[model samples]
Target: MGELGEVPNQLQSFRVQDAKCYCCNHSHIHPHSGESLPCDRQLVYETFKKWWSAGAEEGSEQHLERFNTLVRQRVAPKVARGLGIALPFHYVVYMAVFCMVPWLSDFIALWAETRDHRAAVSMWSLRHFIAWGIVGVALLFALRMCVWLWKLGSRIEKRLDSRWCAVFIVAPLSFFGVCALWLPIGISLAATPEDNPLPVFLFIAAIAITALVWRAPKWQEPLPSKQPSPHVFQRKEDNATFSI
Candidate 1:
């Protein structure tokens, strides 16, 4: 066991094991940031893109300075131009992807289980189908309401308030909270770990993303000058050339 004056390799390994790693969410066995370090400027990039797309005046020095400050603060300015076009369709695409959650969950679970054992899978087939059927019905009703809200949002933009968007978030989150009250009891009854956990995760992610969608920036109140009253424009002398 002895080499003359040799340091032990096991002691070095032990020290390495005890070291702390800052990246990749892994324990020590490597130097700091064994993976790529966090890019702190991603938020700044998003903020810059937001303001740039919001019609920031290029010729104005004040506008450029303000843009820099806003980027520093990581503020998402009003969506404009190309971003405006994309923003309107974001909810539609988000809803489409989330709507498939229930069906996808069922398909994945069934495929994995059937491949393992046919008879065991058949035992729960009808029950699983009924559960997913209920999920589909719920999704259909929710999707219908979301579509209505999207249409209404276009109309409501003229008024410039986010209350409707906030209300939309409230309904889904409240529904999820109510459903979650029963999740503990349901999970306890499942015979195996491979049962339906995706629904709960999907619900939470859906609510969180919905909240993010509405958090960009509040709609600006329309200027009073543009919306002059009907009587304001009714002039007595339409042809009068009144020089200042």
Candidate 2:
């Protein structure tokens, strides 16, 4: 029988050999090619071991919750910052382009109002300047909203009972859903009977494609139990040993 507070040799060996990334559970070695990839397993395992030893029960919900909280405190901000930096680029490229579709007719009308060649040229340039300005402002607001949502997610994660920590994921989906509905309606309202319906179709297709293609940030859940069985940590009265 093992001494109190000592992990069994079998369990310790299993943990050491488990190559799955402790954070995301992504395997470090390619199954087919046998190539090794880098992951957060080293740091995560060290943290896990530290907390696991401190825990009153090896696999209890309270123990897991505390471990998750510690991980989030260390990791969530980095994830949030990464999303904040990366997502805005997608929003500027995809959302901004589709969003400007409704105003296309208005821009053309602004050009047509001045038939004089020089005047039309100046008017067209002015229209572009105004349009781009609006887009820039909108993009700023969108980026700010992303920041706000990440902060909100952090707050939600801090709550003892809350488990929803993917506000960044929700934001893009919500944005796309709104655009999917709004763009078609806007086109219908702004366009005449003779105007091409292609923009409407294109807008819907673009929203669908972006939603599918966009790789949103994923929050890693608490690592699953590595213990071979519940009995690994169960107190044994006859042997007077507590193995983990």
Candidate 3:
């Protein structure tokens, strides 16, 4: 039999491969109080495997939990910074944009009202400003799409437990209280009645897509099935024939 005592080392076994967080300079130290994650789900899985291999010794349970927490604390942050320009971080940027949306609309409305010379201006000038606004929106959307593709490339789709996936769907927007999950639905409903509902519809669609992504059922590998040996089958058949 294989040596049953070759237990895993708690200090070194299940953790992130990297020395420190990609964002934070301190890898060895915790990020907030300094630490948990990225060494995350994998750590949990590896620990389970170790425990199974160790003959499920109950004493090692504490060691598994302790090491898991210690390693995760090293990667975790005190507060969500939403720093990366990539998929996970960009969700915050979208929230920031959502908060600004009303403000931007007000500014535009005030600008239109204050323009006492609108009646005197040519349609050509008005078209130019409208064109610029469209271009800006388009560019913002393009950037978001590229980052989203990069996020998918991170293979987070397979590892749905990634920090950016589940909670982030609601966390960032929670700042405005009602804006959490309600904001997207509200935007779509409010804008759908308007003449130009394209952007709001698009946002709503994006939220739906992300919803499917994060909430999608997690699939675990099925256990291998065992088959009886050919000799066992042959003996059974022989016994059955004789009995009959």
Better of 1 and 3 by lDDT: 1
By TM-score, the better pick of 2 and 3 is 2
Candidate 1: tens digits of C-alpha lDDT, residues 141-241 = 35434444444454454345665665565567546743553343345335434444444444444455445544545333221121112221221221222
Worst ten in a row by lDDT for model 3: 235-244
Candidate 2 lDDT, 156-212, residue by residue in tens: 555533544455454675487545544554554346342344444544454454454
**Comparison by TM-score, 1 against 2, better one:** 2
Q: What is the lDDT of residue 99 in candidate 3?
A: 51
Candidate 3, residue 49: how far the Cα is off, in Å: 26
lDDT tens digits by residue: candidate 3, 119-236: 4233323332332333334334444444444434344434575656634553432334333334454454444432344444454454565456444432222211222111211111
Q: Quote the lDDT for 119 in model 1.
A: 55
All predictions: root-mean-square deviation over Cα?
25.0, 15.5, 19.9
How many clashes in each structure? 0, 0, 11
